[model samples]
Target: MNKYSVDKLPRDIRIEIAHKHRKLRKQRGLSQTELAERSGVSLGSLKRFETKGQVSLESLLKLVFVLGRLSDFESILKPDENLKHIEKLFDSKRKS
Candidate 1:
């Protein structure tokens, strides 16, 4: 089993992400209500996110920004290294 990738897990990814968020919140010593207030998200939304891993984009964004993890998403859609190498070859062919 790959230790770094969660792709093989049977658990829902949303639940896993929410668990990470919940852990981060606790590590930062923030309560759900306090996180809601600080992040400008509703308490109910925060609770739902932590408990059931359900959240709207706006609420999730607010929470992510408040958590100072906005930059963590920068590589979400970044090309893989092998894809990048192939793209380099493709670009050279196009430029020829």
Candidate 2:
């Protein structure tokens, strides 16, 4: 359960990510239009994401790639030693 009286975790995270994107954009000295062009994401998408903190994954990926943060996903959903430890949990859930 969430601790806050007004909890909106997904929105909070989205806003944080949006702020990071904006900070990175400024640090790299690129305007919104320039980032959109270099990332191949539509300018409209960029504007909406910055203003509303919402974006499609495809659009986010394009921006992240252009910003050189794609490696941040290196450990996501990877099945290796950690997966082996919890393999039985996965099987049990699947069987039920």
Candidate 3:
């Protein structure tokens, strides 16, 4: 496994990612409370994620599907460092 860290990410990019996540969530008409209920993520955790851009993949997947942009998410949420690894793994396993 390749280890990667967010330590090299610029502050602006981090902020942009958080903002984008929050914007998408809001565009789907979900209050943090509602999103938390539907996505099984805590309201506090969602709030922190909106501000920090650091949440578990499972929580993010739930939110993305609820936000009506699962396709966009399938592309955008692949952080650069993990892109090649994911591509290789998926290429090896045919999608049903």
Candidate 4:
């Protein structure tokens, strides 16, 4: 999906991206269903996006939270190289 591809992103970045999504949802004070209704996303898909990091079209739509200043969900979706570096440090420490 990215220029480098999803696989190129570090795992920590993936987790961070997932975490940011959850945080944004919570900040908006909307239940999964409410968010879905407003965003035109499905509840089940929303739940999966929150817990599993697997986003559906509906899940992507509910990111608007103008009332809560919780916008920019898309900006945080990108992968980070720092995550890969952190993971490598952990792996080396484990091996040691």
Total backbone collisions for each predicted model: 0, 0, 0, 0
**On lDDT, who's better, 1 or 4?**
1
> How far is 45's C-alpha from truth in model 3 (Å)?
1.4
Q: How does each model score on TM-score?
A: 0.70, 0.75, 0.60, 0.50
Worst 10 residues of 4 by lDDT: 61-70
Query: Would you list the C-alpha lDDT of every candidate in the order shown?
Result: 0.87, 0.87, 0.76, 0.65
Better of 1 and 3 by lDDT: 1
By TM-score, the better pick of 1 and 3 is 1
lDDT accuracy of residue 36 in candidate 1: 95
- In model 1, residue pairs whose N, Cα or C atoms come closer than 3 Å (at least 3 residues apart or on different chains), thus clashing, are none
Model 1: lowest-lDDT 10 consecutive positions? 1-10
**Which portions of model 4 miss their true places by more than 4 Å?**
1-11, 61-96
Q: What is the lDDT of residue 75 in candidate 3?
A: 68
What's the lDDT of the predicted structure labeled candidate 3?
0.76
The 10-residue segment with the lowest total lDDT in model 3: 1-10
Candidate 2 wrong stretches, greater than 4 Å:
1-8, 78-86, 89-96
- State which candidate has the highest TM-score: 2
- What does the lDDT come to for candidate 2? 0.87
lDDT of 2 by residue, 31-73 (tens): 9999999999999999999988989988998898888888886
- Across residues 1-96, which tens digit of lDDT does each residue of candidate 1 receive? 248975655337788889999999999889999999998999999999898889997899899898899889878878776678787898999999
Using TM-score as the measure, name the better of candidate 2 and candidate 4.
Answer: 2
Indicate whether candidate 1 or candidate 2 has the larger TM-score: 2
lDDT of 4 by residue, 26-61 (tens): 776767777777776677777776777677444464
